[model samples]
Target: MEKIILASSSPRRKEILNRFNLNPLIVEAKIEEKKSYNESPEQVAMALAFEKALWVCNKFNNEEVVIGADTIVVLGNRILGKPKDEEDAFRILSLLNNKEHSVITGISIIRANTNIKIIDYESTLVRFRHLSEEQIKRYINTKEPMDKAGAYGIQGYGEVLVEKIDGCYSNVVGLPLGRLDYLLNKFFNIKIL
Candidate 1:
């Protein structure tokens, strides 16, 4: 099996890969995450993911596979990232109180010492139930919303706010395992476990 490197520091992504019994070498990518003014959410995500993968691949000379991913929450045209502070989290949650948002995760895989690069994105629609001020405040007090996109994490306390989801559950969390597995098998000829 080719050595696998994960170019991200997200615990959620690491956990997901671990679930498949694969322990990848963790190498974080150092890239400026600035969204282009005219770029769509999907484009930004893919670009970031690609940048991360490319960065890590350049740093290693061994024949290995590098994976990178970026995720964002979008409500219409606006994109929401990790909140900067408690106030920001509260404001973001207020806006998403009773609305549906889309979570897009872009994944990139590259082969070290080669030009082989594969990039794709998965989108999941998440609908939040109407939340009262107290409910939002209580959740925010837990500090779980600060590190998550759109000020919420579907796999944690924020699950209570989700009314329905219209796509892959894992995509909303961070990575899409099914799509990732397929890509790995097709491109790298490697199977999970």
Candidate 2:
């Protein structure tokens, strides 16, 4: 099996990969998450992920399979990024209250030694419940949403604020394990289980 390398600093992504008992080398891809003018959210997500993976691969041996991912919360065409402060978190949560939004995640894999590269995106529809002001304030106090997109972490206290989800839950959490498993086997012929 080729060495697996994850190009991200997200502990959530690492935890997701750990579920398969795969201990990949974690490499931080320090790239600016800037979007092209009028770029669709999915496109931006995929591009960011590709940039991260490619950045790491340029330094490591081709025998290492470098994987990178980026996740974003989109409402209509507007992108909701990590909050700058608790007040910003409250504002983001307020905007998402009682509405449906999309969580898009881009995944990229590169193995120059094997001449393999993949870039793709997955989206999940998440609906936030009608949250009272008190509820939002309380959730923010937990400090989970400060670093998460859309001012919420579906895997944390934010779950109570979610009314429903229309797609892969893992995507909202940061990584889509099912699609990743498929890609791993299809591209690298590696199995997680």
Candidate 3:
């Protein structure tokens, strides 16, 4: 197998790739993730993903295939990012309580030597079960929601908070495995299988 590089420090993303037997070289991209209000959610996600991949791509040989991903939580037009503190986490969780929101992940794959690049996004609908203020506070105390978008991790203790999901489950976990496999096979002639 060719060397694969992951332009992210997200453990969830690394685990997702490892689950498919693709153990990518972990190289965190040193780029600022700035969301633009001028662009749509999908566009912002894809652009950030591409920038991350591109930043990492410049540091490696062209033979290396690099993957970059960014996940964002959207409630209506609002993009909920990682919480700044415990209070912010509470606010985010409160906003998501008993509501269905969109989880969008942007993915970018690039082979710098060939100048080949593919940028795409995946969207999943996640509905949170109704929760009391105490439940939200206890979950916040767990600190799992501090570093995650939407103030929840569907794969963690936060699992109990979700009523259901309408799309790719892995997307909510930070990567979309199906979309990733498709992109790799179609654009890079690489197969996760």
* TM-score of each model, in listed order: 0.97, 0.96, 0.98
Give lDDT for model 1: 0.92
When superposed on Cα atoms, how far off is each prediction in RMSD? 0.9, 1.1, 0.7
Q: Which stretches of model 2 miss by more than 4 angstroms? A: none
lDDT of 2 by residue, 1-193 (tens): 5688999999999998888878888999988888785899999999999999999888786578899999999998999999999999999999999999999999999995567899889999999999999999999999999888788899988899999999999999999888788888898887877
Worst 10 residues of 1 by lDDT: 16-25
TM-score of 3: 0.98
Ranking of all candidate structures by their lDDT, best first:
3, 1, 2
On lDDT, the stronger of 1 and 2 is 1
Measured with C-alpha atoms, the lDDT of residue 124 in candidate 1 is 93
Taking all chains together, the TM-score of candidate 2 against the true structure is 0.96
Clashing residue pairs, backbone N/CA/C < 3 A, model 2: none
For residue 46, model 3's alpha carbon misses the true position, in angstroms, by 0.4
The global C-alpha lDDT for each of the candidates, from Candidate 1 onward, is: 0.92, 0.90, 0.95
Model 1 Cα lDDT, one tens digit per residue, 114-154: 87899999999999999999999999999999888899999
In terms of TM-score, which candidate is strongest? 3
For model 2, state the Cα shift of residue 153 in Å: 0.8
